[model samples]
Target: MSDVILLAPHDDVAVATRDLVPGESVTTGDGESDGNPTVVVVRDRVPRGHKVALRDLPLGSEVRKYGQVIGRTTRPVPAGSQVHVHNLEMPRMPDVPGASDAASDYAYATEHRELPVPEGERPTFLGYRRADGRVGTRNYVAIVTSVNCSASTARFVADQFRGRALAQFPHVDGVVALTHGSGCGLVPTSEGGRTLLRTLRGYAAHPNVGGVLVLGLGCEMLQVDALVAEAGIPADTLVRRLVIQETGGIRATVRAAVAEIEAMLPELDARRREVCDVSDLVLGLNCGGSDGYSGITANPALGVASDLLVAYGARSVLAETPEVYGAEHLLTRRAVSPEVGRRLIDRIAWWREYAAAGGGTLDNNPSPGNKAGGLTTILEKSLGAVAKAGSADLAAVYQYAEPIDTPGLGFMDTPGYDPVSVTGLVAGGATVVVFTTGRGSVLGCKPSPSIKVATNTAMYLRMHEDMDLNAGRIVDGTASLAEVGREIFDLVLAVASGRETVSEELDLGQDEFQPWLLGTVT
Candidate 1:
């Protein structure tokens, strides 16, 4: 196997496939210099998954990878030296061209490939059909709290289903308390409060939820009545409402909530899963704990699956706004229309101002874990992160937690924080999420299953119990990108059919329903 992998012929750096020793001769090919490859001795020890300078670089020169400018050289560096944070620097934001200039590269997907699964033989999964004609991958009874004050009572209500309490209700996937830290303590009419209210309403009306019991502390800013009204709970909908102030206390509210769920269970349990078309699926894409190989392995593999889904007329949501800072140009250019592309650019501009106000910048990413795994600048990280969207034409752009009403690949504006970003996706009606990670991210989203895909073989083996699939095989040369992508697409069908993911089996989703909190706490 090759010791290093060259992503592009024009790339000034190559990724070390294994740990490289100093003073060792490294082989090169493909005419990177003088139309003929030449050997270059290593100047420093390069760790596995790190980059090696293919040639000497001068100060302030752009460092290229994935055929794009990832960073600039901080100082002159010798060929074969380890290229990382110490020698690399982020590009000036002002120097980066706006998405408007990128519109020239924008083109709708004109080459239509044959469907992966034949039209007549398209795949189907067993899912719960809701009264509104929507299908759900899971049958969850959600106890939603309107404010932090009612969180404990909500938890107490869900705790009634601990262990095999719902064993008789085979169709029920267990009750979950969707609680959060912010709901009150702010102006109820403010934009932040409204966003939070919308998030709660989305969960209540989500198809995956078989029944909903909205619990609230009546005095809070987000009123129970307004929430129920906004959720549009039909007269026949299986939903109940309780307020701590109205019920006399926390214990009473908990008791009422438990009784309400029990009353709703027999019918909720009787709802059986039936075959549903692939178009009924809405998949959310996310990545965290990423490394240098993430773009080459798991991310692009997931992108293929995204493309397949888009081809089938299903919707896929790619989120993590801050994470995709430097890569917005790619998506904007692929947008189905100029307006759609402009919408995406607007969101990027919003993030820019938001970060600046907080005395921070977009380049403040590639967390310590990412740096340790060989990633340097946000540009490099963003370039890899956007691969999860596949090559599908951008269908639309939505605000954080806004309902996803499109039928193809769409982008949702969200933070880079894993749980918070996914929370927005789930609220937008994503029934399943495929999360790719290089350093291992153990995450789950209630009402939506999260399938973790590991980007490296070693991390996959070490955390096999936590990861749901291994895309690392592509890096190992055991499988091709398309092959592993098909594997992931199939797993989505299986997991949507009720196969629990590693995180789900470990019971990790309940606490992860964190709505993106905006504005001041006061």
Candidate 2:
């Protein structure tokens, strides 16, 4: 067996499957024929999951990985040397001709293909069906705060329901306090305010939330009454409201909020899970702490699961706009319409400008953790990140926290930050979130369950308690990609049918309710 894995014929580098020492030899194809293999002697220590030079690279030449340009060589590199940040740097975004023409110049929908209809009976899962025709995987009573000032009181109220408080109410999934940092100190009509409101509304009206308690400080820019009215929450949803000032103080507000939720518990618990079709599922795909094997293993395996769900008429959302910087063109080609393709490009342009204004660039990715895991450039990271969307056509593009009503596959514009990205996905109505991590990121979402998949076997073995599944079995040669993907697909349904993920059992969702704060704080 080969010591290193070469992803493509034109690739200039291969990933070391395991740690390597100097003087060891590795072999790869000569790019002309598989029969004539080329041998290269190891020149330096290559850590497992890091890239190794497949051929001698001259300075200023492009470094190809996954058959795409990841970066440029800073200096001459001999074959078998470890390729990383010290020798490679991100290249500037290519200025494609007719980029000024925007969406029209791209061949939109050229690669669009429809999923074949299944012949047998479609799959089904047990879920809580809401009055609005939406299906939920969990039933929870939510304590939603309107401003930062009321966050503590909301949490205190939710805390009152812990332990044996809900032992009798078997259907209730416990009270969750969805709190954030910004709900005041900004204009209500500004972009930031609007975004905050949208996120709050989405959560309040989410199918998983059977009841909600909207708490506010009364003096904040986001008024409690205005939020409740604008949200258009279904009349059947048991909702209660409280203001800190009107309720006297924190102690008084907590008491009132607790009593309200106590009264709501019986009704919320009365709702029961019923059989629902697979089409009712909205799967959210996100990745963090990525390594070189991420694209080759978990992300692509998750992509296959995403494609399986999309084929069943389910909506699968792929987020983190900045992470897809160098790979937007790939998505554009799979767009179902020119308008959809244009919107994605426009978001990328906005991100470029947004990053510049902050004295940074989109290339400010592949975090330090990513670098240690062998990812050198944002371009390389993005090429791998885009694999999570699979081959599904881009049916729609949505702004942060916007309601995801489209079916098949969609993209939501969000920052590369893990908490913020998953928060947006949950707020946008994802019933279940599948997070692929190469470095073992423990992230969970309230209301929406998060399934963590490890990309490499080492991380999976180290953090087995945190991960729900291991796609690393693919790299271990113990399982095929399709097999692990099908396992993930099966796990999604199981979780939707009321199985608890590791994150859910660990109670890691409450602190992750972050809203994307845009515009200005002041």
Give the runs in model 1 whose Cα sits over 4 Å from its true position: 28-38, 95-120, 233-236
Candidate number with greatest lDDT:
2
Clashing pairs in 2: none
- What's every prediction's RMSD, in angstroms? 2.5, 1.8
lDDT of 2 by residue, 462-518 (tens): 999999998988878899989999899999999999999999998779999999998
Superposition error at 219 for model 1 (Å): 0.3
> Candidate 1: what lDDT?
0.87
CA lDDT, candidate 1, residue 492: 96
Candidate 1 C-alpha lDDT tens digits along 106-168 = 443333333354456888899987777777899999888889999999998889997889999
